[model samples]
Target chain A: MTDGFVTASGVSRHFTPSLPLGERIVAAFGGAVERRSVRAVDQVDLSLRKGEALGLVGESGCGKTTLGRMIAGILPPSDGALAIAGEPVMTCGASPRKTTTRVQMVFQDPFASLDPRMRIGDALAEGPIHHGLVSKAGAVAYVRDWLGQVGLEPDYVSRYPHQFSGGQRQRVAIARALAMRPDVLVCDEPVASLDVSIQAQIINLFLKLRRELDLTLLFISHDLGVVRHLCDRVAIMYLGRIVEEGPTHEVYADPRHPYTQALLDSVPKLVLEEGAEVRFKPIQGELPSPLAPPPGCHFHLRCPFAAERCAVERPTLRPVATGRRAACHFAKTDLNIITGSSSSPAVIASGAKQSS
Target chain B: MIDRASPLARFFGEFRESRAAVFGLVVVGLMIGLALLAPLITPQDPYDLASLTLRDARRPPGYVGTAGFTHWLGTDAQGRDLLSAILYGLRISIQMGLVAGAIGLVLGASVGTTAAYLGGRVEAFVMRLIDLQLSFPAILLAFVIAALLGQGKWQLVAALVAAQYAYFARTAHGAAAAERHKDYVEAALSTPLPARRVVFRHILPNALPPLIVVATVQIASAISLEATLSFLGVGLPPTEPSLGMLIANGFPYMLSGRYWISIYPGVALIILIFAVNLVGDQIRDQLNPRLRR
Candidate 1:
């Protein structure tokens, strides 16, 4: 499949301090109005291929959701450009209805996503009805079919969201998104709030939908296992920028960046042999406030491999291998490779050869 | 037949069992019946001045008057039958309360929802207006409004509507504001649904229960406000005697031997207010989950 159905170039969004009560008083007293800028997303360039499931793996405050929101056009970017299927992402001034119909988002909390007062059928029928995609009677039939596709009973269409379980609500959310027949689906941790078994079910459903509908998916999650299982390619974000990105297997098997390596090592392995040695290097320190991100490399304060040069010179995402990229100066050499205990010399050698 | 014992059924059943609500329902129902059957039930047309006999005027209840048993509750200062006056007066009072409450609800819901949804400067302005209105006692505001508009049933209704709309608007605005940030609202926005549809069809319906309770309570408040205005002589015109007017006119005779003339209408007024308050309380209980259990 061709790469990049939806693409963002140097997209940035900043939220300025609103005129708070204190600020208003200060202004009245002839004091200087101090407005702080919170850069939620900063100059991030990314692309999602057609029918490809691209997982955005990051910690809670890494701005993955913000980036996803920008991609969905729910929030307008302060600067730069975003496009879907070779067309510019419609602005707020333009026909907002048309733009919203083309792209849809499934939020993290499923229960909150569906209106409690609305019956499932009404909720599902709303989009199609507003868009004039189907007649009212046709929409009812379509809603039933979509419900079945999401593994919900057709008879349950009349039920309210509160009557359903968490997983069922999420399924209803998915069904709602599917009803729009969006070209790109941006799911912001759709399974994060669900149970582990339910998470697996949702992940499987996402994978299934991706194949069946030939849809482009932007899946956001902090769970590495989930990213590894469902994503075709993975983008690792730190602060508000992509630190490492490549094919899912490549990034997991041989993560070149120090941050990527640390993340992989932190994952609890199934078994450890005697003297196999588990040097767990959990990511130290809490994330700094986005309102005032540190100078130079944002990760330099917490990065283990931080040098004098690393602190001064900010790194940009540069190509490392074919279809793979990372934003570290020492991405190729400084990262320590950890070979699997089960691997033979021949297997390791062959694997290294294949990677090269 | 249906199970008739579901949670909703139980809720309705509890409402039916509430003494206050039941009493209020009965009183309201009786008042409505009285209004509908006023012409047929009453022996004298209270509004017709020519039909009244001067000799029967100022007679107390159970008095051996010119009319005898025909005027069972006796006659007013104008020789109007007290029973007939009460029926007609109640009709005016109930009409004023309902119309005023309805106007308040519509006005409040519109203003409040608009202010909340389109926040920033609009919210501040609307909230300030609400604060200003709330500072004055509602009954005082109604009296002032009625005085300015001139005294009549419609004028009093208008006064009550003006006094009570701010309360409902503030309530509905808060509810609508809370619902606006909900994920479903955002979800609706993310879909191809129009902004108007998202705000009204999706968000407004979910936000209405609290406002519904507020509207119910306001009905009681509206009735009381109207009565207070009428008692002060700034409400309904003298031609139409509401319960408040009857009480006002009978106050002088209250000191004399005839107690039933003022006492019966006062009792009816209390019972009507009590019934309305009871129904309002039950609605508040049913709508609010914390109060339900």
Candidate 2:
């Protein structure tokens, strides 16, 4: 991960909720003052090589969106160093501001992602014209080209956002980002809001655009199947921290982290044999609140193979094999804990530790 | 589902759908025209003391003046023609409302949008000030300001702007703050365009519909506020009599069976406000997405 193209090292984004007037007055009279900060993204290290697609997979409130936002230079990190191709993305000061234009983001909701008042052509051309990528006179043609690239009609440029369907709006959003000539594209569940048929078409568009533009992509989603299909590498997040990261095939085949193993096992599998019964074992335990995450491992309460050390000591993300990392105290141990039987898709194998 | 017309044309297209709004628009246009043409069309210059005669004072409607001109709406204590007084008053009242409303909208919308976009302590400070100001009655605030900066056209305007700006600030802050968190705004910010551009070009456009709705209603309020101040004798100077002053000047005669003095100007004021409010209501309904159908 060292010397990668897009790098975020030791990044942390903490947000303190402001107390309302009544609460402040109550606290002034010696009432219990609530001052807990939400650690949305805490001390995370991630690196994406140029032209490589990294899938950031996690359940809701796992901070995948916040991480993607920071990487795309939309939200400034509370603390960390983020760089794209050796150029710092955020300017350091009392209030950090995003300084780079090398990255752009695609939001999950197409309906809200576009300005309703602006015409499609104007929305797509706004960034390019401001950045001097195209002249005002040339913006129409530039916007049309980008629109066509995203499989939208050039004539659709004259319309407002409300005039388009969910699928069409997402296409327009992609074109708007691409018009900025961004080297890195951060898609935060771009197709999650679209119809199932539309999702496949948009996914195909992303695949085509990634190859054609040779772009470094950060695909953030909770859908494991989509991430597995689209991403080359996958990083699993739990309570604002990356717990495991590796090539998609290796991690899906043999998940070292117990959390990752449980997540994979939770996915329903198809049985082709006659009279084959399928049992769905959902991961046990609720996701702890990010406001006050468990002191040690965030996944300890949910991990089937959680040891005594897992509850007390925080496990750093350590190398468990070539091109793989897992944050678990027993990740490299010979503790054979069978969370599911052989019929279960994910059988915990202590054999990965031997390779390390 | 696409309309190729410009936004202004589209708004007008939608505006014409309501018959009452159209009638209000026509009445408003007619009033503005009457005010603008008052100097050439009025039979008398109401401000010219030399043209007045004390014998013509307190005449009932349709009385023949000594100058051989019929006072269709009668004369006040100063014998100034009520019709002429109202036309001139229209000019002053409309101008005060528009000038005050425009200045208030721009000043307060900027303050509010800036506060919302640059949130945290700045927002808290601006919002608190706005809240404190809002807690006071608008007319009371205007009265206080008018009392402090007494007896002039500009003074009343200043009072109206000061009194009404908090409403604009509150409205703009709410609209812009809601818009600031929308995905479009975040997407605009991610484009790396300057923050100023994002605030004005992106956030402001979406926030403006509500501000515009506020502006129309506020303009009507500003006009009424000016009338109230003038009636209280703290508004426009005697040299520049407005509708409220005319109504106030004629009030004493109302008990003496000479009702034309105050009644005519009061009726004019009501018509103007009614027309304006009608237009404002239609615009509010039109802009609200829930009532669009």
Candidate 3:
């Protein structure tokens, strides 16, 4: 929390979706309604300094989107604290109006994010006009100027979202977010829904916009390659918690945790050299349901080297190196090799300990 | 947008595309013109007691009645010129329809959007209320309302408004509820704009096409409701006879073999409702491009 622009401490978000009327009636009669709490994000900590971009990468359903939502002031954490620019924001569900202008979000679906009936000019200019940043007379030019910044032509200002291609609409969305001059932009997989060719163009636009605006970004995506391409630092999440965090290049180059190792291994070319051994080593077993995560380490059931310690006690995120942390008992022993390292043959020893 | 057709040009072009709507436009336009020009078109001042002769009553069509006046459609039991009666009656009916429809649309759209945007208990309560109101036949509700409010033009308007507003409310709520969940709507909320502007300018405009379709249909239904209430002798005052009252009055003469009195106004009522309903149908089809073919 010290001097960080956006800081989250022990932020957790849980969702207990409402049951249907029939189900509620049944539950009232002592019948089961199967009401299960989904812990989308659990005990997460994240800090983003001003003008820094941190990529949150995880498999689909990991808490990346939820965490990104909390940072954007869109969703409240069920438990924990979040501060933006050192001021605590209203969280859980009621997003206070004051911080709304400070942080803006770019949605994953461009088509769904811009009103189809509204002209692009109105969509982009609404924020500036709403906050009294620019008078209505000045909003036209203000909108056009933002259009150019997002690499869109000024002619697009008069067009509706349906009139533009998917890429162009994404540009409109970006311009709409930037029009407010927000300090932080939470992009939740902004490129995932775009075409591959359009993806690079949007990514480059984001990079350029960040430089020109000196904006802080909390980027959430499942693409590790894109994360490495755009982020200065990266955090890998498993289930509802971040399993590893460090400088993007360092984590990509030397992944510390077994899950991180498996993530890099799963990607065909994330770490593989041009002729390096390319193996499709996707982690074994289905992702455990968040409804009932295993007693100890969430990933231990799938880990090849699951030790008795891994099964008995969940390892906390321990700082193993400067600016690098991993939530695995064997992280200090270098998890790339199947066998245990010298410092702790305890990994295999504990397996025998479990068997004995 | 690729088409450089100006908005005005595009509007006319789209209007031309739907032949039925164009037909509806003409029928509705003619009805409005007739309503506005009723004073100049009527040969006799039907409202004046001095303008009538009892001997002219029950005259067949084309009859040379008192003062060289000829009954075009024929005379009623009161010697009122049948054509004159219809023109004046239509004027009142259309005016009520327009006013009632406008009031109903505004009330319904506001209630619907508020129900959707506020959600939670507000949504549940508003939607349930709309459902409860809709469960009863609209005309029956109008009957009870008109009966309670007493007979007058404005009272009829109030009854029509109550009868019709729920349609707009339900349609508008459905559209706004869906639009509220869209990403653009969420993005708007994430901004510093006032909630009113977001709901009115953004949500309402998107919700309008569906409500507009509902509005056109409601206009037809409103006119019909007015006629029904008037037939029950609870709509417009007797001095200002509506098409529905005319039909009810002429019904007594039907057994006597002179049918022109009630039949003429009945035909006019059907034409008006049919024209409005067709236009509404065309609009619904035009709004959804999926139905274009």
lDDT by residue for model 2 (B1-293), tens: 44467677778999999999999999999999999999999999998989999999889889999989999998889888889999999999999999999999999899999999999899999999999999999999999999999888788889999999999999999999999999999999878878899999999888999999999999999999999999999999988888999999988888888888889999999999999999999999988989887
lDDT of each: 0.81, 0.89, 0.85
> How should the candidates be ordered by DockQ, best one leading?
2, 3, 1
Instruction: Indicate the docking level reached by candidate 2.
Output: medium
User: Which residue runs of candidate 1 sit more than 4 Å off their true CA positions?
Assistant: A1-3, A17-20, A90-98, A271-280, A333-356, B1-20, B63-73, B257-259
Would you estimate the TM-scores of all the predictions? 0.90, 0.92, 0.93
For candidate 1, please provide the TM-score of chain A on its own.
0.88
Best by DockQ: 2
* Superposition TM-score, candidate 1 onto the true structure: 0.90
Interface RMSD of every predicted model, in angstroms: 5.3, 2.0, 2.5
Which run of 10 residues does model 1 chain B get worst, by summed lDDT? B1-10
lDDT of 2 by residue, A56-77 (tens): 9998999999999999887889
Q: What are the candidates' C-alpha RMSDs?
A: 5.2, 4.0, 3.9
Give the per-residue Cα lDDT of candidate 2 at A86.
90
True contacts kept of each: 0.63, 0.75, 0.61
